[model samples]
Target: MKLAIIGAGMIVKDYLTMVSDIPEIKLNAIVGVEQDVPTMQELSEKYGIKKVFTNYEECLKQADIDTVYVALPNFLHYAYAKKALESGKNVICEKPFTLKLSEMRELKKLALDKNLILVEAITNQYLTNYKELKESLKKIGDIKLIECNYSQYSHRYDAFKEGKILPVFDPKKGGGALMDINIYNIHFIVGILGKPKSVKYMANIERGIDTSGMLILDYGNTKVVCIGSKDTSAKIQTTIQGNAGSVIVNGPTNVLSDFDINLNNGFSKHVDDKINDHRMYEEFKKFNELVADHDMDFVKKELDHSESVMEIVDMALRDADIQLG
Candidate 1:
């Protein structure tokens, strides 16, 4: 898939680091605002991206690419993805998909109408370890509880504490613990359990945003607590408990790195099956393959899953009375 990347942010840098490893993907161009021209130029030179455009419209009209990766901030996702889809390009947007479920619905409808692939760039659902974990669930018997914690004190938290508001901590920009960090836990759980029976979010709010939060999802037979924080740190771990056994994840939900499954009948083992060190690698690789093959069926399946996740996000935000763009 010939791809035009639409950000010069950290996510773009991470993607640049691993783009070479994915043979099916070609970095045709990089697009950023005029202020980020230098970064774009440096990235383009280093990654061998053939062109760089400061304007999205110019890139859409001029770049020789079939796909656009919307790696911008959360609030920009809908507008940018919509533009790309309207330009007749397949779109791969960063998580949270959009700030609102209604926006997500519009993008979904647009993509389906155009017969173009549009997917949310969530890592866990595409990871090898995540897949293995899903398969190993039966070994643990009926799932009774799940706890996923993905908390790291943000580098910008100190600045925000000092009253310096950046996009990440700015509620108007869709920045908060629930959307930024907890959504991974949401995807990890929802991918396995589909939609929950009900959802609620409890948040630690500061300056009109959620600095940290606990999202509770009720799945009838199973109970889930997803802890996501940007205001504090933790030894990030996730666990799936059942009647006979439990599976413990070694790391956070985003990087489903390694896990241990221990059962009551004296069977236990460690599993580590991730194909790449970078969490974004597997998802982008899958995106490339799907777009290349024009596999709309699989793409639609993922879109449906993403829609469910977005629905839960909206519910969680409403439950907490936290408003975000």
Candidate 2:
């Protein structure tokens, strides 16, 4: 994949760290703000990328680039990704997909129409442990309750407290517990439970944004409780309880390190077989193959899953009486 990355943020830095492990992903170009040019140059020298453009349009015109990675702030995802797809470049958009289901629908339609691969860069769905967890669900028999907690008191919250608003706390930028950290929980649950029959969100609102929240997903057959908070700290855990057994997952859903399966009959097992140390590796590995094969069928299948998650997000936002500006 001849890639053009459009952000010089922390995520991009992390990608560069393990990018060499995925040799097929060629770092063709990087585009960012002029203010970040120095950092961009630093990255270019380190990654051996030849093209660096402060102007995204110029980078988008690079004939050698095959895919665009939209790693920008939440608000820019829609516009940047749409431009990439319109330019006939496949896109791997960082998660939260979009702020609205309408935006997601339009982007999916555009990608399909253009015969381009558009994928949400959600980590949990692509983790080998996550895949294993899915298969392990059967051993647990009938699932009755699900609970997920992904919370870390953000360093950015201190800036917000001092009246210095950063993107993570900015309502208009689509930052909140739900979009920023909670969506991973959403993906982890929705990916397994499918779309809940109904959803409700009750959040701790501050500055017109949800700093922390509990999302209740009513699946007629089972109930799921998803908790994501940026204003508090806790040991993160995801538990799936079934009549016969239970599955326990520790750590962030994004990088599912390992899981334990405990059955009612005293069958206990630990699973740690993983593809790579970096969380993004598995996703990009699968993404590269999907892109290489031009697998529209598989792409659309994942797109549909992303769409369902977005729909629940939209519903949660509405029911919470919160709107992204």
Backbone Cα, N, C clashes tallied per candidate: 0, 0
Over the full model, what C-alpha lDDT does candidate 2 score relative to the true structure? Answer: 0.92
**Worst ten in a row by lDDT for model 1:** 15-24
Please provide, for model 1 over 258-287, each residue's C-alpha lDDT reduced to its tens digit, 9 standing for 90 to 100: 999999999999999988888888988899
Mark the regions of model 1 whose C-alpha exceeds 4 Å error after superposition.
none
> Which segments of candidate 2 are over 4 A away from where they belong?
none
What CA root-mean-square deviation does each model show from the true structure? Answer: 0.8, 0.8
Candidate 2 Cα deviation (angstroms), residue 39: 0.5
Best by lDDT: 1
Q: Over the stretch 92-198, how does candidate 2's per-residue lDDT look in tens digits?
A: 99998889999999999999999999999999999889999999999999999998999899999988989988999899999999999989999998888899999
Clashing pairs in 1: none
